[model samples]
Target: MELSLDAKDTAFRDEVREFFSTGVPDSWRDRVRAGLRLSPDELTGYQQRLAARGWGAPTWPVEYGGTGWTPTQLCVFWSEAARADAPHQFHQGLELIGPIIFSYGSPEQKDYYLPRIIQAQDWWCQGYSEPGAGSDLASLRARADRDGDDYVLNGQKTWTSYAHVASQVFLLARTSHEARRQQGISLILAPMDTPGFRINPIATMDEKYHTNELFMDNARVPVANRVGDEGRGWEYGKVLLDRERMVAAANVIFLGQIVRGITDAARRRKIRGRALADDPGFAAKLAQFTVELTTLQAMVLRLLDDMTRGADSGPRGSMVKLRWSQLYQAGTALWVEALGPEAAQFAALDGATLPADMPAALQGALYARVTSIYGGSSEIQHNIIARRALGL
Candidate 1:
């Protein structure tokens, strides 16, 4: 499919580009470029700026503070943001839990959470994966027992991204064991400060505190905290998961990273007085990767077109996620190879001194290792394609 942006879409893209160039705080941009993590205040400030512009919640309905932009506009907005090195708007709140609350949450829940989320008053984290339940999410053992008006929750959540920085967590808890493994699950919203909640950081190869292990011991949350009916969380979770998968499939952000990787690799001298880009073998590989990247980007735009035209239940989302993850991993591998040993030895440098092109490309390659893992693993995406698209 040939991907072309209309005049209106191009205008919208320019608007978004201008906004990021001028609207996003310089400090945040510098931090992202330098490969340093944003402080909590800096992160919240950036999100609040988006929220102020009514660009905070991209995919939500307008009633819930969504920009109500067309899918193409959303695509452009994401591309511009990534290119400008803007702070990542954590999706756990806006992308994942906010939708769940708006869809299945009670009116009280909506009134209580949605506005704050849009205002950046609260940061949210996902409490889904547990120690043996990463991919087999239905096997999660986090339990919540109803008592009076409260549910006492007890269990652990591993790889909970940004939990330490969040004020609340949207969790999945097993309320019954008699029904199908997936059937008895319930979604709960618990304050991070609730008694018996502990967050321990998980160190990754990048030396960043991006993930955490959350332990909930007798955490008491009100029944009012329950989203949707009990034992139907599995169904609700599927809705949220579908949204997550669709967003993940949008390869715009990763595409920008790949572009940067190629540019950086080309500029740096490799061996024999030649840059990596001058090497025919490297050039061929870059050309091939770009072709695939372009194709995947087109697929992404097509998916957005379908969504803009009000098509739901499209399998292209899964296909995009699957292809993008594979292509990204491959592209990053090529990028690191081009960097030679420097890719491995580059310490996680502070954002201030980082060369513009190299840090993000290098760190992004490292972070892409989890792209296939989180938001549903590559294996799961394949299963979805086979079952939904291939009919195998």
Candidate 2:
């Protein structure tokens, strides 16, 4: 069936697709389609191009360089962008911290940061998870002592995605000592150039430096760097999580795009002198996945519909995040399994080359392994679902 978008939405979608088809760099789209990581230059190039079009931060306040699109429109933009292999703007800057800054930051912070974020001038990484306190974020021991016009921060944040490359890091630090652990926290934006700030790179199984261990040894942060009121970061951080969950929820559609590539591979690969697509078992598996993908798409659209009507997303973002990660991981497993030995070979496609030892299908499978870990572990999300949604 055609997209469930109405005539107006369909028209808008066509416009976006056309824009992505022609406006986005052909070489960059080639890299995204082949699962090749874009170089830093290419990534920022795409981000700036999107910003120049006013599509860089679609969900932000229009006054802050956002599109002011409805949730459905936002959903359409993402789905179409992914299908067209458009490089997404950096999430730390575009999705996570931008909203936090807008909602809880000072007007001066907004004026300084929002345009830079949209224009891809500043790269951001999250500093929420600490060495000893990740899932139990409120119990974090990373303390920042107030010192006149500045706060002296001393702590280590682990699994800080892209911290090594980021120009800034948004930190959740304990600024107060109180009986209520949650009430002692505050959000601080630290420039990467701060004295005593460092990042130790950590490579994933995919052999990508997507994460790092962040060390802040008596880093000097100006009071002006603090967002919102002191001792309220736990609350603001939750807002960021809610937004993150919305992103993880949308992963269902992006992951679904892999199915199309898999099918094309199956068509070209022969099994016993016939196409793998002709195999009954493979066909059945494909059919099952189609059903699952359909359900996921429908569920996500419903969530977006609610947001379009101005209903709060709330814990439902967690629900979708949990389900999307699980489903996408499972689907990736099938992709690798179906490809078997053929996926073992690496060949350049769409002007992008795969890592010599890593085939496209296996690369995807390996990457999917971390879906349940980031954006809060499945266990953490389960607890959130139980406590907030189920009233446990």
Candidate 3:
């Protein structure tokens, strides 16, 4: 598919580019460029800055503080943000649960949560995954049994990113057991400080403190905290998952950034008095990666365009997720390779500033190893594409 931006779109892109260039603090962008994790306060502050400019929630309706930009404009914003190494807008609240609350939540829910989400007043994490149920999420066994005015939740959620830092969590609990799995699931909201909630940090190979194990035992959330009907949480989760799949576009943009960084580093390094970029072997690999990045980018733009035009676009999200995962791993691998053997050295795990691109590339590659696993595994995406996109 041919992708072209009209004049108006071009102007919007320029505006977005200019803002991201100057609006975000350079210190924050530097950390992001170096693949260093930003503190929770820094993240919230970045989103608040976006909020001041009315750009906090790009995909939400204008009524709910969204920019209401078209899909293309949203894509442009994301591209520019990645290029500038802008810290991402808080995704769990802004992208994942915010839209769901506005669309399916009660009026009180909207009043209480939507503004805080856009304002970044609260940190949020997802509570959908469990030790037993991950990609096959319907098998999740977390249960929330009803009491007089609240549901006593009992279960554990693993792989929950930012739970340790979050103030709130949107949880999926099996509210009914007699019905088929995936039919009786309910989406519930609970404060992290609620009774009987515990968080355990999981040390990842990437040396990041992002994921956590959450234990909830008799956690009392008001019945009113349930989003929408009791039995349709699975449907709401699917909506979030579709949006999550499309998020591969942003990762694709980051992969491009990694490749560019590697290319720049290669041009600066010399082998036998010749720049590494001058090596035909390395150049050939770079050329291949360029072609692959271009193909994947075009695929993402086409999917966004399809979505914009309100087309069915069956399984294209899965296709993008699958392709982007593979390409991300490959790109990060190239980054580490370009950086040489020293890139593998372990850096401090204290979220300290990575001094240079070498450590960044190494940590990124380590993290990239899980690109295919999270947000639905490549295996699952392949199955989805086979069944829905290819009619297998």
Q: Which candidate leads in lDDT?
A: 3
Ranking by lDDT: 3, 2, 1
Give the residue spans of candidate 2 off by over 4 A.
23-37, 345-358
* lDDT tens digits, residue span 187-294, model 2: 999999899998898878965558899898999999999999999988887677657645754565565566665676668668889998889998898888878778
| Candidates 2 and 3, the one with greater lDDT | 3
Local distance difference test, each candidate: 0.77, 0.78, 0.81
Q: Candidate 1 at residue 271, lDDT?
A: 76
Displacement of the residue 250 alpha carbon in candidate 3, Å? 2.7
TM-score of 1: 0.90
Which whole-number lDDT from 0 to 100 does residue 339 have in model 3? 69
The estimated TM-scores of all candidates read 0.90, 0.92, 0.93
Candidate 2 minimal-lDDT segment of 10 residues: 27-36
Q: Please give the lDDT score at residue 201 for candidate 2.
A: 89
